[model samples]
Target: MNGDAVRVLTYNVRRDVASDGEFDWAARRDAVASTLRFHRPDVIGLQEPLAHQYADVRDALPAYEWVGQSRNADDGDGEFCPVGYRRDRFERVDAGTFWLSPTPEEPGSVGWDAAYPRIATWVRLEYRRSGERLLYANTHLDHESARARAEGAELLRERVQEQRENDEALVVGGDLNCLAGDEPHRALAGPDEESPLVDAREASPHPPHGPSTTRTDFEGLLPDRQIDHVFVAGCDVAGYGVAADVMGDGWFPSDHLPVVVDLEL
Candidate 1:
């Protein structure tokens, strides 16, 4: 890293249209575009990226190079995780997706108690500043399964350990659906010699009950949970924060706020 740090962001854009039925598809697209433009992260990890949704984001930000893989075992529509990066800032060295199952090879495979298929998308990015490389992994955990969440966390740890053999920085981010001080977070925060994962949420600017990382507008001011997170390893994280895009019109870019982090490779 030419002595300059890189900024990374993770956002889980709700795939469905608004429940209020006020904003059309175009409005939703524009909202997302505006949010991304305002943040301008070096690398972005997005969840619930459908085919059309991915195209919309790409069209809005043409300068970004992107890659995505479906999580549905049946290969049907629904939700998928997609990652995008600034073409000039980072070069993709490698990328792939694996199911959150004991036997991950079987595509569209379902894991224990998982309501739907789950996957983790990983990419090796080379930072232009210092010529340093880092591995990034993004995923959305199953909302309904305890076993899936625990196993998924272990799987991610194993995957990161394997990738660390390459001697690169590591970062993992997504809507884990697990709260602070949970088992899943504990698994990712385990000790390691080369790269120990650290939770960026705990290091955020907001204090408890100030500005939460996520808010469910489904009900009137529903109980908030810090489900979304960003974890870093093998890199020096300068700072991190959650983007509260709640506008005066009571509209947000997504249900979950985007988490941003500045890191030195």
Candidate 2:
């Protein structure tokens, strides 16, 4: 990697569920780690992982450290959206989580017309090599409610605007459950001039690699459901891709493919 470049990956690991059968976490844990290891991301944002599931990945990637909390509990008991970074390369300045609701500070608060409570995890890090700081956030939006997703996007935008210091580079990523032209995407990366971020894929000079869509459903991939994305500010997108890696058994690591972006900060 170049001195100014950092690779970021956004993935939805799909919470451990027995109903997943052959694709269960116990069966694919190593595959998930292998995929991540192969990509060698400097920073990662993961969605839909329970505590145990996150722990499994954490164990495999010894170089990474993370910050996250469950959407349902302050003690980290439920599903989580976690942001992780290379500990040897970056020193964490601060970290926290906030619910995607009207009462953002209230843990487990449900927002809008959503069926489930959602949250975003964030971290402020200083790159050890360059001494540059970055504010990175990760989230999972409600799949069942358009209103919830749109409002959640606005809340994230507001928080990013409020917390950013001296225009330090910003990166926010997750399973937004919306397409490129969707309201939530528009809210974050707008045709309007005031948007704080832009889609990394759109900013890259080279075309994206791998499949156009990001969801695989374990059984097969869909053509139009590219819900995973990374948005950035004050950086240049050097490369972007959708990773469709699989284990030797031919099973994908999770239901959703990982989205990767190489950024020059």
Candidate 3:
């Protein structure tokens, strides 16, 4: 929206878990902080974020503002998706989350067939430069439930469509846990039956050197399969690419790599 294009990133930090067999929570925290510092994204959608982890990032980047609710309503201390952005560049207008089930009223309720509670955080942000406004929604789809993933995709599509009708630039980003060719991706991208509602995954160019944006911790080998993405609607994407920070120091800050995009309002 501003004369300066906004840079956005989406990452899933894997609940600060590391495969190195060394459970140094402090090191994990530092890794997360360093990753953010390296990219310096204007806005970030982080999945599997804990309150403590959020605090670390907030303290490290004092200028950024964030919002999100726990995945579980019971304070079970589990993972959740938290969205953060640089306040000086964008002003938050509204923010909230809804359940991924048929009865979406329950804020933190676990959806049917979902392995864990799923939530989508939505925020309305105003770009300071051009005085343009946009809506962003971030979430992690149910990793193990096919039904839940399909339904979640549909729900997100509907929400984005509603927001687009208001003539606002829209972008959705997150670690969807589904491949670019999956059903969930297709559903959100507007399955063949309707006009494409969203442009996701391959909508942007990927880093040239990394194995996709996701990797398994098996013996530290990097494999291919991009599960993280930045989706956009009602906006023009000027430039986009994935951040290959994982290739540094023989260690990955998280299981999933962060994706960044530059947009023109």
Measured by TM-score, the strongest candidate is: 2
Q: Least accurate stretch of 10 residues (summed lDDT) in model 3?
A: 200-209
Task: Enumerate clash totals for all models, in the order shown.
Answer: 5, 0, 1
lDDT of 1 by residue, 150-184 (tens): 88888887877787746578889998889867878
Candidates ranked by TM-score, best first? 2, 1, 3
Mark the regions of model 3 whose C-alpha exceeds 4 Å error after superposition.
Answer: 1-4, 17-20, 193-196, 205-210, 216-221, 246-248
lDDT of 1: 0.78
Per-residue C-alpha lDDT of model 2 across residues 83-105, encoded as one tens digit per residue = 88999889999999999999999
What do the candidate models score in CA lDDT, each in turn? 0.78, 0.92, 0.74
List model 3 lDDT by residue over 121-141, tens digit each: 888888887678878888899
Q: Estimate TM-scores for all models.
A: 0.89, 0.98, 0.89
Greater-TM-score candidate between 1 and 3: 1
